[model samples]
Target: MIRRINDIVAKHIQGNLITYFFVILFFMTGISSGAFMSKALTDFQNKELIVYLKNFFSIVDSKAINNLAILKQSLLNNFQTGIIIWILGVTVIGIPLILLIIGLRGFIIGFTVGFFVKQMGFKGVIFSLVSILPQNILIVPCTVFIGVLGISFSLMLIKNKTRKNTRYSIVNQFFLYSTIIAMIHIIIVVGCLIEAYISPFFIKYISTYM
Candidate 1:
């Protein structure tokens, strides 16, 4: 099973190497920018953030996290993002926007980890591992996948612009695109469940040490 999956992935990557490269590069660039932004925080801002982190820890230690609220927010955010990317895939002008969205997602994650490590050092790393990494393991890949799909679809539309009798082909491609997006969202739903139900426990456990 693992071998088959690997073969499939290898084939996909081989076929879409340029798209994957651009998508991954853009995401990495965003991460680098976010980390730099974290470093550029003023002393006052750093202090304020430290205080906020402390309060967050306190909440986790007290087990005060509202799980349902978290789940609802996660689902809403994930689904909204998924829908946006899916829609963008159907429009030629949305390629840049899709890439930008992917980059922004990376930036948020990079800024968060960069801040944690900068302030708390090793303890901060542990805190980030428990609180942030779990859900993002799923989310990061899904975001990139959707971004690639969006860009690819937009490019397809542009490529077929001069061709005749392509309406049926476009419709077929769109259906396939939507189907794949639906599958990606199912994975996202699982990621959200992990974020809300499982990560909180890890956060609560680690908060005591921090």
Candidate 2:
């Protein structure tokens, strides 16, 4: 079963390498830009920001362990994002909007990772691994995949159709695409569990030592 799943995933990724590459590039640009900005900040500004971040971290550390609430919040947020992406994919003018959202998500993630890594160096990387990477490990790839697929489907409407294609064919493809999104939705929920239940504990443990 595991091998089969791997093979299926491999096939999907292999078939969309270009799309994946561009999506990855878009995300990496955000990361790089964020890191550069972090690095370029004045020393005084950096110090002030670090102080704020540490205080924020303390607040998070002191929060009660409420996995259920966390999970619900995570799921709701991800679900909303997924639905918006899907809805945008169905519209003619949605291509740019989809890209903007993807870029924004990437920017936020990049800024977060950059902020920590710059503040604590290697320790920050460890902190990010524990606190940030768990959910994003699932989310980032799935998000890119969905974005690529959504763009591909949306473009079908604008493409000059050959004789073999019909509206019904596109409709079928949309349904198939939706089914894939549903599977991704389930994965997001699992990611939410990890983000809620596991990441916090590890992050707290890391913080105590840091």
Candidate 3:
């Protein structure tokens, strides 16, 4: 399994190795900054963090866990993210923007997880697992995959546009590319459903009883 995962990753990152490496570095940097920021909080700030988390979790009544509004919001939010990547992915101009957006997304994940872990201790770790891990586990990989495709497509576009004898027609290639991106959007929707419908249920149970 480990070797299979390595092979899969190696294949995805193969052509765009340097691009992915720099993207991963940016993500790790964000994660480190978030962890350090947690450690640097003043005592009062730490207390405030605890209070904020409590309020965040407690805002909705227990019954609201399955609320349709919440699900709609979650789905829309993730949908927007996926769409952003999809649209930007088609243009050579969007390469740097895509990388920056990915970096920012990672930063947010790191900051939220780091802050929660710091405030709640072991429970923070548990909460992070239940609340953060499930959907993000899906979304993160999707983002990475999208980035790889975007970079690859952009490079292909540049080569095709500049080359004297282009091997593949741009129009046909784009139709197939777009079809795959649509499938990605469908996957993002699934991730959103899991985040909205499933993650909260586990978290509520864990926080209350465990």
Candidate 4:
């Protein structure tokens, strides 16, 4: 069973290399642009985030003060959505659709972080890391999984491998990929919760001393 899972993972990685490259490239470009932009808007963005945080802290109940669980669950929900998009992309017209879906996801991350870093200066970069890194660590794997599954299906189409139980192959692939995606979602949520409640206080203290 381990070997079988490994084989599937290896195949998925090899197949999706091209798509991964494009996605990474686009994401990096966005990050670079966002960093520059963040520098331009540092004061504004910092002020806004600070104000927002203060407001959020004010009315939030003591129970809600510990929002780690909610943040974690939100990350998991996001990953599950990615999994759904991947499954949909496997259908007859789903290949390009998957690419579009992944691309958009990457774009949003790039844009937000880029704008953030650009606006905050070095502190902005630090803030971005504190804010997005935890969730992103979870998201990257999910995105890669989607890319691999999409590529695998595309390969099947190109090679005309639709014979001798093609339906079974499709079903198996979907099941396997979905399971992995779900697992990733769970892991990410757990990480997010920790980061949300715990990291902020530590980060804020550290920033003050620095």
- The predictions' CA RMSDs to the true structure, in order, are 1.5, 2.6, 3.7, 4.6
Where does candidate 4 have its weakest 10-residue lDDT segment? 56-65
Flag regions of model 3 displaced more than 4 Å: 1-13, 40-49, 60-63, 164-168
Regions of model 1 farther than 4 Å from truth:
1-8
Please give the CA lDDT of all the candidate structures: 0.90, 0.81, 0.75, 0.61
Between prediction 1 and prediction 3, the one with superior TM-score is 1
Please state the error at residue 176 of candidate 4 in Å. 2.5
Better of 1 and 4 by lDDT: 1
Better of 2 and 4 by TM-score: 2
Q: Model 2: per-residue lDDT, tens digit, 52-171?
A: 988867867787677888889988888888888888877767777777777777877877788888778898899888988999999877788788777766777567354464788778
Which residues of candidate 2, in runs, are more than 4 Å off?
1-8, 41-48, 61-63, 160-165
lDDT of 1: 0.90
What TM-scores do the predictions have? 0.95, 0.85, 0.81, 0.66
lDDT tens readout by residue for model 4, 30-86: 456555554555676768965774454344422234565657566666756566666
Candidate 3 residues 61-95, lDDT tens each? 34456547767997777767667776776777877
- lDDT (0-100) at residue 62 of candidate 1? 74
* TM value for model 3: 0.81
Give the candidates in order of TM-score, highest first.
Answer: 1, 2, 3, 4
